[model samples]
Target: MGQGLSCATTQEHGLFSAMQSGDLDTVKAMLERDPSLTHQTTAYDRQSALHIAAANGRIEILSMLLERSVNPDVVNRHKQTPLMLAAMHGKIGCLKKLIEAGANILKFDSLNRRTCLHYAAYYGHSDCLQAVLSAAQSSPVAVSWGYARFVNIRDGRGAAPLHLAARQRRPQCVRILLDNGALVCASTGGYGCPGSTPLHLAARGGSLDCTRELLAWGADRLQRDASGRIPYLVALKHKHGACAALLNPSSAEPLVWPSPLKFISELNQEAKALLERALMDANREREKNILKGTAYSLPSPSHSDTGADDNISEASDTELCCICFEHVCTIEVQDCGHQMCAQCTLALCCHNKPNPTIACLNPPVCPFCRSAIVRLVVAKVKDCDDADQDIGEIGSPKMRKARKSRNFSSEGSSSFKGLSVMSPFGKMGGRGSGRMAAENEWVDKP
Candidate 1:
């Protein structure tokens, strides 16, 4: 029995050697001499002559083996079928011959669970993927095979084909998967690293063209990964300023005020302060430019001011206080040509205080021309009493007494009775005593 087994083993080795060397005539002669040899296992790697023929792309030998009904589904110790070996080596003719002989197209390797399609995409072999896809289409298990091999197939680490393509910067593979309806937003199975949406991956990779393409395809810019970071912020964090700017232009402005004392509230303080400063400076510069004509530095006219020839010429030429949004009363112009009301201008300065630098206030621009305030306005409120009086007197005793008496019940006293007074002079203390005191004070003045 030992000698008989030795003879059988020797014959199998000879057939295996013939298959490996693509000696189809020798393989056919050996198989024909012993019909039982078709079912015989080979020595060495245990791969039969059919397995060797398919792997080496010997289409004629593979056909001859299949015609004899050699087990096409048989796998070696690695659980790789003959068809898998053919596909991996890009043996298109051998693969077609095996498929025609009814080889399983969707069989996965036992070690890696990788179907033939995975190998094709991994190697970037478009033709291989096409062949596998075509064979899979007509199979009885087509739907199951499609799902297992195409739709959600993931590696041991849960990385879909798209993830691999992205990490490798394989744009062509990415496009193929996208065309095949692969989910670009699928997350990998890991912790602390929320898997990226395809857009996030593109941005993180600094593939601007890919990023734009993903955006054009409706990728959400505001989508956050597992880390609470939007894609734009991620770009900024990575110092991709150009990408961040493209994603959100408003982020470029001084939207946040560093100090708390500048505004009434915390929320939107930066935005409000920025807008307020911009509007004030814009108005101030517009007035300064109008006053100085060609000599002043002016921002190019904005679209809103396009038809302003009538208004710019007809409008008052006096400089306006950029801070208060009022005409520059008691005008004080900074070296930067920005004008402000003298009082408003000085309020921005740190006179009679430590750290008297005008930089402390961080004004947006010049108070007069709305350019920029290089040196602070040191002027104070002039003609304070005249300005106050124009609005209304604050401390006149007659006015005070009249204001006080006007609130009193008219029925309470004889002093309040019959106090009918003219409208203009009525509230000034009813004409007699108030009028006489006023005249006396006027006579005493100057």
Candidate 2:
């Protein structure tokens, strides 16, 4: 009996080793020699060949094992399915295969009682996280548990996936989960701190990106945890000076995602990305102002992988914004066809902080024509020759001269729409003194 057990253990080790190293021929030969080897698991953890393949990103071996009628939902001793392992290790290929093979994304492990979605968010695997979320929309779990419940599903400690992602500093995962309807302000039971929201977790973790994401999704910075501490206090406690600067209740409010506008929801992906980047840039400028003299300093803005310098060169040929001549006109009022820079556009909309007590919020009006802004999109840059031709189409020499003079006068003063210009060293001398002066500052230009 002892000899037979020793031989079985040797075969199991070989099978697992073959799966881990992605040796397809050796796996096939071993499987052909012993058909039951496919079902064999490790003696201690009871991890099968499927678990090893998925964890190691051996998609070919995983596919072969699945095709051989092996259960994709096979759990190890910790009750962790191969799907969980795939997500935890960011094996997107294996994760997709398992999802297609009917693996359960809702299976909770024994460790934290976290599902594959939680594992994906916790491990900062954005691709795997998105895949699992996409699968959950059509999987049987969607019908049984409801999509919203699955998105905000809690673990043993009652921490939602958003809480985990924020605490782990997974900014992309946090954004993905928020876009897919994860509650931005859902509180946890015991994770990080009791009754802590995702924003609180982000603050405690000292992740400015994660905190910015949560705030853009309309997270309440003033919401306190069970211990009566807000996210600002949490950031200050952790000595995250930059984060604390942004979260300070007295500081100017950062812009939130423009979800209230119906047209914003209908924008194309490219247009949406441009607008989101613009919004983040505006907030970063505000944060810089708030942290001007502090010991903590923000890193320079990281440009997108798409060549930004090339875009900058292209932008130089475009028309300058009449509101802020420093920047190129990049945003367009779709309905009226008026153009402005992104900074001016954001200034028009984010003049006031959000008030949760108000049930109805008004849309911002276009600064040029005073018309309610119905739609906005990224202005497409025209070729240099085309722009020159368009410039020649102006009806009157006097009209062109008047427009040029207006732009020149507004060149250095970007204090449109109640945005007071700050001094280089954070001084506010000669600016409007009171709230009444600030409210009256947004006069229409001729």
What does candidate 1 score on TM? 0.43
lDDT (0-100) at residue 195 of candidate 1? Answer: 58
List, residue by residue over 1-446, the lDDT tens digit for candidate 1. 01011113577878877777789889889888898876766553456666778777888888888887788888765677787777667788887777777887667776566666665555555565667666766785567646434644765556666655555445555655654556645666541246566656655656544543343333455667778777677677767544454344232111111121232122243333333343334333323333343332345445332243234322222222323333322333335322234323323321111221232334333322234334433222213243423111133444333423432422322322232221211222221111111222111111
Candidate 1 ranges beyond 4 A from true positions: 1-10, 40-45, 143-149, 164-173, 190-446
- Residue range 304-413, candidate 2, lDDT tens digits: 31354345443243355665455555677787656676655655554233455553346666655556777887764333333522332334444444544544454333
Model 2 stretches with alpha carbons more than 4 Å out = 1-8, 303-318, 351-363, 368-374, 381-446
The C-alpha TM-scores of every prediction are 0.43, 0.79
In model 2, the worst 10-residue window by lDDT is 427-436
Backbone collision count in every prediction? 9, 0
